[model samples]
Target: MHFEVPKVRMHSLREFAQHYFMIVLSILTALGLEQWIEHTHHRHAAEQASEQIEVELRGTLDSIHGALANNARQVAPLRTLKEAISDDVRRGLPDAQINQHIRELKNDFVLSVSWPSFATQSWDVAVANQSATWIDIDRLHKYATAYAAQRDASNWVTHDSTIALNGPRMVDLRTRINLGKDVDPVEFLGILQQMINTSTETSGHLEQTAKPIERALAEATN
Candidate 1:
């Protein structure tokens, strides 16, 4: 069996062009609106991310301040330890009274010395999602610089902690006290001096690094 072809109507060139123009215009308009919506959503997300990051940085600053104060409190004890050790070396272990001093050093200084770490979740999220790019370049640069300083401070803290945790001095102190054995005062004094210097420098640098970050966060929030 043969099938008959159906009759079809064809458009004039002018009608076809007019239809084509409308279709293209509609597509372009839809694309423009979609792009605008996406842009607005991204900007809003970025602003939220900035605000959260600022709050987080403020918290980080507070942590740094607490750590600084804690470190500062160790200074006197460290000096006393140095002096006591020196006296022991020059003369002899002072007396039972010195045991009180030793206990104080252990309680106040050794146990108290610690490293501070901050949570950067907001910052990490913003950066990971590329929302940080929405912030002005200057402000972004400021944030980056502050974080860089924090990274340096963290490195110093890690170095100081390594010395504290792994040094022979800590072992010697523990052994001397627990066993009531005599430590080589001269060797102990040298180690104590190095620790004092490390703690002082690390605390100072951390404060300096954190202060600028705090100020920047304040400005950003404002």
Candidate 2:
């Protein structure tokens, strides 16, 4: 900035003081404007990051609901065949009769279960770029809690399966069923119980994860 030169040379200290303060005021005003602009930018960035994360949470909620439904559907057929086999064995039916009952109850059964793929891509990106730091403290905390729960659920799905499920035995059962080979009814019954237990536990974990995400989304709307 160029300063205005006085038409007449300054003849008093008062004039010089007036000129100096004008220059200082001009510099302060410019600095204040820059600070305001920076604050606005950070605020906008935080808002955008929050919006993206909320959208992702909604998608995750949808997947969780879908998974719960899908798993229920898978369990239905399992329960049906499990009941049939259990009844036949309790009745002291011979292996041939049990195998025939099983064939009729589960003609094309496939052992399978659905596991939801939880996502935190938006949250991860926000953190990587430091945009999450710009968010309001309370809001940031909520978002962090939601994503952390999602991660926990995902990890639990993996860890629980390894710890609680009999992978090799389940594979053998599935193979036998597929080949129409005779299965020991009592042994097969135990495996079905395991499958049902795993499915229920998985649903429990997903439901827990869904709670924080649903709360976060609800708060965002408010």
For all candidates, what are the clash counts? 0, 0
What tens-digit string does per-residue lDDT give for candidate 1 at 1-222? Answer: 223333434378887777667667777787899899989988898789878888888888888888888888867687777776567556765555455455545543353454567777888898999999888787788777777788877776666545644366666776676666544545556667777877777777887888779767866967
| lDDT score for residue 103 of model 1 | 52
The lDDT for every candidate, in the order shown, is 0.71, 0.83
In candidate 2, the residue pairs with backbone N, CA or C atoms under 3 Å apart (3 or more residues apart, or in different chains) clash, namely none
Which regions of candidate 2 deviate over 4 angstroms?
1-9
- Write the residue-wise lDDT of candidate 2 on 1-222 in tens digits: 455554657779998889778778888898899899999999999999999999999998999999999988888888888888888888899998998777676643445677777778899999998999999898898899999998787777667654676768978977887788988888888877887878877788888888988888888988
Residue 7 in candidate 2 has what lDDT?
63
Residue 208, candidate 1: how far off, in angstroms?
3.3
**Cα shift from native, residue 45, model 1 (Å):** 1.2
- Candidate RMSDs in order: 6.9, 2.7
